[model samples]
Target: MNRREFVRWSGLGMMSLLLSGCGILGTSAGAAGEEVQKNSVSGGNKMKIVVINSSPHARDESTSIYLSDRFSAGAVSAGHQVFTFDGANEETHPCRGCDICHMNGPCVFSDAIENKLMPELLSADMIVLVTPLYYYGMSAQLKTVIDRFYSRTGMLHGKKSMLIATAYDSADWTMTALSEHYATLVRYMDWVDVGQVLGIGCGSRSLVEKSSFGEQAYNIGANL
Candidate 1:
């Protein structure tokens, strides 16, 4: 089947069923995912959304996850199929400068990149990046994961993309670089622009929880 057709079929609940079974989440995230599955809306203009979250903190402690939880709940309530890629918990390493993937079939690293990440990315209709600003940029682990996309650049084209970011530096300038980076990736992938929730001043879990950014995130998903 064609990509559009496949995504349409996925909206029929096949992909929703796989969301919880994919083993991409830690225990806490996994339990929450079960709720998303249970509340899924059936037979509409649904989508397969892959959330790439790159936070080093544990599932319980991470502010990034907090925002993602809000976004996922909103998306599920709107009937989209959401699958989160817990980048920190997996074994995805930085792309070694082997330069082999360009001339070879795939990269040498065969852990999460091969086993989990690429599969979902290939099938996803939308890609959401949930990240904490690290020195005004994406986290190191997330950068590494993106680097590994070298092998499948062609396959990843033409998807929709969104960003959910948080930073302790409340200055508006803090998100400038990260936003530019995300814009660059969107251009590179030829992705349709979706809304973003850039949570400025969300320095900690409690801060993110208390922030209206969560509601912004929810509205993004709900309106979609």
Candidate 2:
């Protein structure tokens, strides 16, 4: 579906879900019943997806933000629960190579990773990493999160992964290194590589606003 149509549909779906517990769905049992019905219809538990958006820009104009939003919309529409993290805004401590986490214990830092992200990572069925390309590689903020994953060793194994990268350069080569790195990381974690979406030539917010990358991102999430 096109971006506009997807957005409209998603909005309507969200409204329906939100109102399902408010007597709008003609159910007296409230939201709890709605959830059970949904799970029953699906015949299994809904997938839990964690999306880590590592773009430094806090505004919606960033290409990474746009793609991540679209992906989240699609995933929610597909009955999956999505937890998103703004890596740049989060209080994540850099991995100090203290080798403390390697001892099968938590990292020494008492930051967001230990208090919040580790639980999400361990419970997620799928993980999506969204970042802006920096010097033909993932952003340092995102790299920090990846590095911190060392603390979890086997916690993330066998999960599904997707990468969405945006770059200012028009050439596809600009994202090659980042893509390879993501692939290697997925392999090392024993996670399946679901897909990768690269947004190129997005030097200006206007270019990204006018591109089909958002629709592609939505489709990726929908199909996942």
Candidate 3:
């Protein structure tokens, strides 16, 4: 199936099942299952993770997209109940800064995040954002979503979050812009930091494929 079709269907499925399971199967069943398997517990303290991939490139083989996919696979292997969203798709509309979310309780765009993402967040124990560097910062697409997340206010409070970025520059300071950006959110929501992966020297997909750090990044995802 096409990427658009896949995300559209996945969003719909997530919404339907997330709501249904609340009454019939009980909330946190999926998250609980992961906890039992990963933590050696039966019913307590499960962690739900929602990973958002913020690369605007369309191809499945883009550096950031592949990294995000690998991370998702690793998260599943680590026994975490994970949900993934491709921020590259246009289905996720840019936040217009209209402040409609203040009264609407979600982004006024209402396509990907409002209907699908909020439920995942409500059900998740943690969040992971994976993106590529765009002008020394997160891709413009991701910045938009991050801004929209402001509407969530205290909803994500106390939850764990991590940032993963792949860039062409090897300098540590290359990620400073995103670090500053996420720092504000961390301060705003009072979230705990699980980890952050800054993969440098990776502007092209070939570079990402050739880089040794890609494997390390994948391991980070698998272990987290």
Question: TM-scores of all models?
Answer: 0.78, 0.78, 0.73
RMSD for each of the candidates: 10.1, 13.7, 11.7
Lowest lDDT block of 10, candidate 2: 20-29
- Model 1 ranges with Cα > 4 A deviation: 1-44, 103-105
- Steric clashes per prediction: 0, 0, 0
lDDT tens per residue, model 1, 58-149? 87788888998888997798678998888877888787767566522367888887778888888998888889999999988788878877
Per-residue lDDT of candidate 3, residues 1-224 (tens digit): 23243234334333333332221111121433444444321123336888888876765567877766666665666666888877767477666767665523666676877787777886788778888988887887777666666556446565667777889888868888887776555544556555566778888888887876566555555555
For the record, the alpha-carbon RMSD of candidate 2 to the native fold, in angstroms, is 13.7
Clashing pairs in 1: none
Q: Give me the candidate number with maximum lDDT.
A: 1
- Candidate 2 residue 74 Cα shift, in angstroms, is 0.4
Candidate 3 displacement at residue 87 in angstroms? 1.6
lDDT of 3 at 136: 85
Candidate 2: regions farther than 4 A off:
1-45
35: Cα error in model 3, Å: 14
Candidates 1 and 2, the one with greater lDDT: 1
Q: Whole-model Cα lDDT per candidate?
A: 0.73, 0.73, 0.64
**Sliding window of 10 residues with minimal summed lDDT for model 3:** 20-29
lDDT of 1 at 130: 88
TM-score of the candidate numbered 2?
0.78
